[model samples]
Target: MSVAATRRLNLVTEPILPRIRPAIAALAPYKQGKQAGPDAFKLSSNENPFEPLPSVLEALQRTAPINRYPDATASRLRARLGVRYGVNVEQVHVASGSVSILQQLILATAAAGDEVIYAWRSFEAYPSLPLVAGATGVQVPLTADARHDLNAMADAVTDNTRAIILCTPNNPTGPIITSAEFTAFVERVPADVLVILDEAYAEFVTVPDAVDGLAERVYEKHPNVVVLRTFSKAYGLAGLRVGYAIGHEKVLDSARTTGIPLSVTSAAENAGIASLDAEAELLERVAVIVERRTRLLEGLRAAGWDVPDSQANFVWLPTGERTDEIAAAFVANDLVVRPFSGDGIRISVGEEASIDRVISVATSVR
Candidate 1:
C-alpha cells in the first residue's frame, strides 16, 4: 500500500475512546482541607477536636464479620435515629456520609436540563454534587453578613429547578438560617422541588432561633423537605464516614435507590449507634468547642477583623483580596486553615493551645 494508505489503515486500527462529558471534564475534583505537620494543628476540615468516646471505640472494636458485607440498609442505626427524631424507620436514610446522601438525593431528583439551587460560598461540595448528576447549579450570592439570602434564592427559582440545598450554619461561613426565615422561604419554594437542609454542624449551634430542621416537625409537615446530619462533626466520627437523612418515606425511598449498597460498613454503623448511646458525653465535648468558638470570634472581632457570628465549630475570616496572603501567614505559623482565595479563610476551632496561635495570626494580618 502507499504511504498515505498505510497511515490511514493505522489510524483506523488505533483505539479511539468516546468523548467524556464536557461537564465532567471541566469539573474540579473536591479539594480536601490541608493536613498539618507534626507540631501543627489541622484547623482546616472543621473536624471535632475531641476523640471518640470509649463506648464508641469499644463498639468499633467489637464490630465483627469482616468477611461479610455490611447491612445494606443500616437498619439499627436508622431505627435509632428515627426514634430520636420521632420519625418512622422508613423516613431515615443512612449513607457513608451526609455528603453521600446529598449526592444520592441530587441523583434521585436532578439530571441534565434540571437546576439545583444553593447559596454561593456554602458547602464546598454543594456545587459539585449537582454536576456529578448532570444537573445545572444555580448559586445565589450570600448577603454582606455572610448569611444566605433566602429571598434572593427563592426569586432565582424557575420551572427547571428541581432541588434546593439549605445549609444551616453553612460551612466555612458559619451562619444558620433562622426558623422564621426558613419557614417563609420553604413556603415560597414550589412543593414539587426538593429542599435539602444540611445540618452537619447542628450539634454545635447555640442560637435559639436557628432552624432546627426537625425540632418543629417541619419535615413532617412538608413532604418535600429533607434534613441531613452527620456523625463526623459533633460525634467525632469523621474517620468512620456515617451520616443520615430524615425525610418523607417516599422521598427517602428514591434516594435509597441511588445509594451504593452496603457502602456503610458494620464498624461505622456500630460506632454511630454507640455515639448516639453516648450522646450526653459527646455533647459535652460540643460545649467545649462552642465555648472555644465564642472566644475565637471575640478575639477576631477585638483584633479588628469583621468576622461573622459563627454558629458552627469554625469561623470565617473575610480576608477578601488579602485571603491568600493571610492564609499563608497562618500556614507559616503552623496553622492550617481552609482559604477560598479572593473570598476569605475558614479556621476550624481545634486544640485549646491552637487558639492562641490562630488569634495571633489573625491579629497580625489585621
Candidate 2:
C-alpha cells in the first residue's frame, strides 16, 4: 500500500484495540522464585523437599479420563475436608491452590472503592489479589521483630474495608499470630467484613501457642471468617495444585461463585485424598523439616545473624539495603534464594544436605 493509505489503516486499527484497565496495566505481574540449576539447592520457593507419598503417587497414576472436565465443585474432596474439620460439606471450598481461593474471596467481597488489608511484606500475592479485584490494598506494617501488628491492622479498617488477610507464620518474615492476639484482633474487626486466615504453612508450625484456625473454630462464631490451607507445602503436591477453605456455607458460596470453573483437576483431588489417607507418614516428613528449621535457626544465630523466630519451613534474613548483594552471594554458591531488594531474603528450609551449604553461605556473607 502507499504511505498515506498505510498511515490511515494503522490509525483505524490502533483505535480498535481493546482498552486495558489502568490499575491492571500499571500492576506488576507475579514473580515466581528463580529456578535452580542441577547442582543448586533451590531454597527460593517454600516447597516441601520430600517427594510425594507413594500412596499419593499411586492415586495420581490411577486418575483417568483426563479428557473429561474435573468436578467443578470438588464435592468429594470438600466432603472429606468437612469430615476432618467438623464442618458441613457446603462449608468447604476447594480450588487449584489456596492463592486462587484467596483471589476468589477478594473478588467476592471487594471491588472498586473498597479496601482489603494485610500485613506488608507478608505474602507477595496478598497486595496483588486485591488490586486485580479493583480493590485498594491497605498494607499494615509488621513489628520490628517481623510479626504482624494486628492492632495496627485493626485500626486501619474502615467502613470501606471489605476483607482482611491474616497470614499466620507470616510468609518470608516467619512469625505466627498467637491465639490470644488473633482472638482479640478478630473481636476488633467489623462483623460484616470478611477475614481470611491463611494457614498455608500450618503443618510446619511447631510453636505451642500458634493460632490453629481449625481448632479455634472462629468461623463458628464469626460467619465471615475463612480458613485457607494447602497440600502444596506439607503434602508435597505443589505440582498437582490443590488447596481448600473452611468457612460458613454462605461465605464460601460467594467465593465459589467467583472461582474459575473446573480449575481443580481430578488428579489433584485424588492426590489430596491419598495424602489425607497417608497423613501420618506425611506429617512425619514435616517433623523432619521442623527439626531442620530449628537447626538452621540455631546455626544462623550462632553465625551472628539476628534472625526472626520462624514457625514456617523457612527463615528470613533481614538483609535490608544489602539484600541484593547478599542474594547474589547465595546465588554464586548455588543457593537460589528469594530476595526482596531493600527489604530481606527468604530462604526455604529445603533438603537436609542444603542446610550445611546454607549455613556456610550465610556465614560468608555475614
Candidate 3:
C-alpha cells in the first residue's frame, strides 16, 4: 500500500495500551498450590481434607440474595468472632480471607518509599504484597532450623518500616515462634509500626507455648499488633473464603478503610458464623490433624529425615538440593506435595493412607 494509505490504516487500527505500575508490572502474582490428578492425594495446599460441617451447609442454603450486596461490616460474623476471641465486635474485622486482610493492612500503612518487613520463606504471598502496595519488602532470612530469627528481624527494622508480618507456625516450615520470643521482639519494634501476626493455621497448634495473638501477652499489651485467622484450614471452609482479624479497633479500622468494599460475600459471612457455632466439632478435627502431624513428624524422623517439628497441619522436609527429586517421587506415588525450588518440600497432613505413602516415598527417595 502507499504511505498515505498505510498511515490511514495504522490510525484506524492502532490503540493506546494502558500502563500498569512498574512495581506491579514486574511483580509475580501469588500461585495457588497445583491441583492433583484423580486418585492422587493432594498435599500441596494446606487445606482441610474433611467435608464442611452440616450447620455450615445449612447456613449457606439460607444465604442472602445474590442480587443484594453483602453487609459492608460483615457484622454478624465479626460479632461472633469477637465473642469467641474475647474481644469486642469492633475489634474484629472480617475479609474474604486473611490474605486479603494482609493486603489491606499493608495498603493502609505503607506506600511508595516505605518498607514492610516479613520473614523470607514464610508465606509465599508476603514477598509480593508489599510490592503490589508500591512499598519495599524487607525479607529477613530464617535461621538454620527453618524458623524465623527474631533477633535478625528486630534488628532489620528501620525508621521507614511501616509494617511487620509474623507468620507463626510459619507456612511451609511449620516452626512456631514461642510466646516469649514474640513478646521480646515486639518490645523492640516501634510502637507506631504495625505488626501483623498471620495465624492462618492457629487452630492446628499443639505446642504449649506457641504465641496466641488474642492472649493478653500479645494483642492486649501491644496497641499496634493485629492478629489474622482464617476458617479455610481447620473449619473446612476454603471454598467459602472467610477469615478475620482481631486487634485495637482503630488499627483494624485502617485495614477496613483500605479493604475492597463487599469483598466478603453473604455466603462467606454465614459460613464463618456457622463454623464458629461448630467450633467444638471442628477442633476435634484439628486434634486429629495434630495427631496425624505428630505421626508424620515421628515417622519422617525415624526414617532419618531431618524435618522440622511442626505445630501446624503440615510438615517441612529440608530436602534442600533434593527437594524437587523427593517431591517428584511423592508425585509418582500419588502424593502431590508443594516443593520450593532448591529450598524444601512442604507436605500437608492428608488422609491416613497418604501418611503411609509419604513415609514410603520419602524413604524410597532417601
TM-score of each: 0.95, 0.96, 0.95
Q: In candidate 3, what residue range of length 10 has the lowest lDDT sum? A: 212-221
Write down the lDDT of every candidate, Cα atoms only: 0.94, 0.93, 0.90
Q: Please, what are the lDDT tens digits per residue for candidate 2 over residues 214-292?
A: 9889899888899999999999999889999999989989989999999999999999999999999999999999999
TM-score for candidate 3: 0.95
Error of 3 at 149 (Å): 0.5
Estimate the overall C-alpha local distance difference test score of candidate 1.
0.94
Please tell me which predicted candidate would have the highest TM-score against the true structure: 2
lDDT of the structure predicted as candidate 3: 0.90
Q: Choose 1 or 2, whichever is better by TM-score.
A: 2
User: What are the RMSDs of all candidates, in order?
Assistant: 2.7, 2.0, 2.2
Model 2 lDDT vs. the true structure?
0.93
Query: Model 3, 1-366: lDDT tens per residue?
Result: 999998999888958789889888887788888799999999999999888888889999999899999998999988888778788999999999999999999999999999999998899999888898899999999998889999999999999999999998899899999988998999999999999999988888878889988765367888899999998999988987888999889989899999989899999998888888888998998898888999899989988999987888999998888888888888888899999989999999998889887998888777
Clashes of 1: 0
